[model samples]
Target: MSVFAVEYVYAADTEEGRDTHRAAHREWLKGFVNEGRLLASGPYADGSGALLLFTAGSEAALLEELKQDPFNMQNFVSGLRVTEWKPVTGAFADYA
Candidate 1:
């Protein structure tokens, strides 16, 4: 599997929708966490977006999985970016 950095850009005026779906979103993420696919995830301090770290077989596979996210399904995300990363050191160095 490869490590991927997934970026989620929140759409403006969607705070209420995001709040309503937060539980479902976290539940969906828990499934991945249990499977060891999701390493870490959280919203930005500024609340403009979120960052998620995951391990997947490929970018295609990761995107496919992300398509099911409640945030995506609810259209709370204005943009999504997925980047394959090479973690050369620190907590994720082993992934490299």
Candidate 2:
């Protein structure tokens, strides 16, 4: 398994709109995390965006899974970046 980092940029108008879909969005994400597809994910605190760590065979596979998010479908995410990474010195490094 390889790690993929996904950063989501929120559109101003849709940023605040996330509340309306928060429940469903979390529900959609729960299955992925429970299955270990998602390692960790959360907002950046500044609220401009969020970060997600996924373990997948490739970036393209990760992208396809991300497309299923309720938030993404609603266009709450204005931009994104996906990169494969290596974690060698942290709790994440030992992730199964």
Candidate 3:
């Protein structure tokens, strides 16, 4: 599997929508964590976006998985940036 970093940018004036769906979003992520697909995930302190680390067979597979998120389905995401990541140090060095 390859490691990937995904950034989720929230749409302006969508905090209420995000809050309403937050629980379902988290619940969806929990399944990935249980399957060892998600390494870490959380929102930025400023609340502009969130970052998620994942392991998947390919970038396409990762994108497909991300499409399942409630946030994406609800159109709460204004923008998304996805990139393959190579972790060469710290706790993730082993994966490298």
Winner of 1 and 2 under lDDT: 1
User: Per-residue CA lDDT of candidate 3, range 13-93, in tens?
Assistant: 999999999999999999999998889999999999999999889999889889999999999999999999999988766
TM-score of 1: 0.98
In model 3, how large is the Cα lDDT of residue 43?
A: 99
TM-score of each: 0.98, 0.92, 0.96
Task: Give candidate 1 regions above 4 Å deviation.
Answer: none
Clashes of 1: 0
What are the per-residue Cα lDDT tens digits for candidate 1 across 45-96? 9999999999999999899999999999999999999999999989987876
How big is the positional error of residue 78 in model 1, measured in Å on the Cα after superposition? 0.7
Error of 1 at 82 (Å): 0.4
Error of 3 at 78 (Å): 0.9
lDDT of each prediction vs. the true structure?
A: 0.95, 0.87, 0.92
Model 3 Cα RMSD, Å? 0.8
Every model's Cα RMSD, please? 0.6, 1.4, 0.8
- Whole-model lDDT, candidate 3? 0.92
Q: Which stretches of candidate 3 lie over 4 Å from their true place?
A: none
Total clashes for model 2: 0
